[model samples]
Target: MLITVGDDTATFDAFDQSSQVHTTIPCDTSEPGQVLLPHRTLHDVVAKLPDKPITITHMGSAAQFTCGPRTFELPPMTLDDYPPLPDMPPAVGTIDWSDLAAAIREVGAAAGRDDTLPMLTGIKVDSHDGALTLAATDRFRLAHTTLPWDGDDLDMLIPARDILTLARTTWHGDVTIHHDQRRLGFTLGDTRTILRLIDADFPKWRPLIPKDSDTTIRIDRKTMADAVKFTSVLAGDTGQVVLSITSGQVTIASKTAQDGAGEEVIACDTVGNELNIAFTSRYLLDALAGDGTALMTFTQPGRPAMVWPDLPCEEGKVPDADRGHLLMPVRLPG
Candidate 1:
């Protein structure tokens, strides 16, 4: 990267060759020429300097950084050796980066990390009639959510780790998106990111979600999550947690041959039958990692259960297809 020192100001041009990003900083410069420094090298050296203001001097063959009594001198690399950054495709639409990021985080939590099933390792981005849906599954559980999009209809399966980088990142400004058959891009303020879409096909997940509930547990989201986290401590190597439900209360419990047993009971506003349901502690923890009242539904022993942020559900009402997680229960050894 080139740092062009001028009379009035200095510019740190990272995306200059690609013309995608540019940032400026105020500096008092006596070195009016270009200093070609390795980006990582300069960043590491300067990060260790004292908090005082730093003064940089561009020598004939090297550059020196001075702060207080500390001094760091480094030679500049040849500017012609740096390769050009690949430019992103034209933007197809724009979205609030924060909003889009949050939706991804909610849905992408269930994506599988095991590499054997390549299909489940991605988050499917499906757009239709200006609405977008994101879905992911790890065989044992599934998560999906929706967002409104003002873009063309398309289906793209992107790697969860790469796509989630956008969600986990802290940035500002609306995100301008660019996509084609194989690539996806996001431009937020001066930052631009490009990722290759996964070639694998995401499984058909819609039909896996159970419609009817024989048992439902409704409670404060934080209350349930905290109880599960605390009770699961005795789960030991299996990481299994059980929920024993009654009419107005539920108990969280865990036990193993090597670890002692533990349980906690909490009152709740719930309806339906009383039963015990077993689930992976981590799965329940992940599902409850959000706000709002927690609503979980079950069909019977050994069937898949569903967790949701409690919304209105009337008789014969079909749950929102795009806004909940479907989790398969674990079978304790007989």
Candidate 2:
């Protein structure tokens, strides 16, 4: 780590050589010099100091910190041993902070946690014309969302954990992105982070989404979520729940030999034919985490189901661009 102090600003730069997670934070300060500080020691000393203005001075081989009435001295390390920060590549594009954060939360839920399949642990970001698509899948289910952006055709896969961490912490307003084949960088407010791109190729997920469905049900998102929660207690080892849609209601049920069975019903407006299907309770719960105003579409007893927020749209048609989750159904044991 390297700490550089200027007349008006102070910068702290640190890099994790193995993970390729590098960050630089620059903020207003009155000090003017540079030094290589022990990262952990400096952090601990500063954190425990009084909340008053702090004064730091270099005294030959040691550094002095004065806060209020107390004084502390620390030995400084040789600045020559610090490594240089990585250079930023050319600017690729920019994205709104809120949009990027929301996309990460929506898509990251489907990113696989298994390290054995490296590609499934990444989130694919694809930009074309004026739209940006973010997607992730874990074999059993997939989640995707798109937002408006202005950029040329570009595609990249970033480690899901790193991007999600930045989105939750450092993103404040608009974020400028810089990329070049193997690496990517994000600049937000006073912090800039550079990460190495994942080398594995992401799966082609477009064809996995079914274009049409035979049954579409409009129900209160909260009502459906509640029913699933109420019935999941008996899901047992399979973590399965059955959904039977008929007439004006949808019934959710689960049962196991060791655990007692449970069922809950929610009123819903239906279109097309009545259908029955089964799914993992956790998957359905994740897909319905937001406000309960979206609709769930089903194709057949064994096909994947699509769930999306009920945004303004044509009388009876849902747009293809609406943010949603594509959840695969579980084969019911006969």
Residue-wise C-alpha lDDT for candidate 2, range 1-334, written one tens digit per residue: 4667776766777767413344444445655788777877887888998899777787868888899988888888888777666788688778888878888988998999898998999999888768889999999899998898885566888889888776677456788888888887877766777887888989999888776767778888778888898889888888899999998888999988888899998888777678889999999888988875777788888888888777543433544654789999998747
Per-candidate Cα lDDT values, in order, are 0.80, 0.81
Candidate 1: C-alpha lDDT = 0.80
92: Cα error in model 1, Å: 0.9
TM-score between model 2 and native: 0.84
Tens-place lDDT digits, model 1, residues 1-334: 5677788677665543212333456788766777778777887888888899788788878888899989988898887875665668778888788888998899888999988888898999998877888999999889888888897666888889877765788866678888888778887754577777787888988778788888877788788899889878889988889888898999999888788988999998767778888999999888888777877888787999888777776433335545888888998634
Q: Taking the candidates one at a time, how many backbone clashes does each contain?
A: 0, 1
Candidate 1: where are CA atoms >4 Å away?
1-81, 315-318
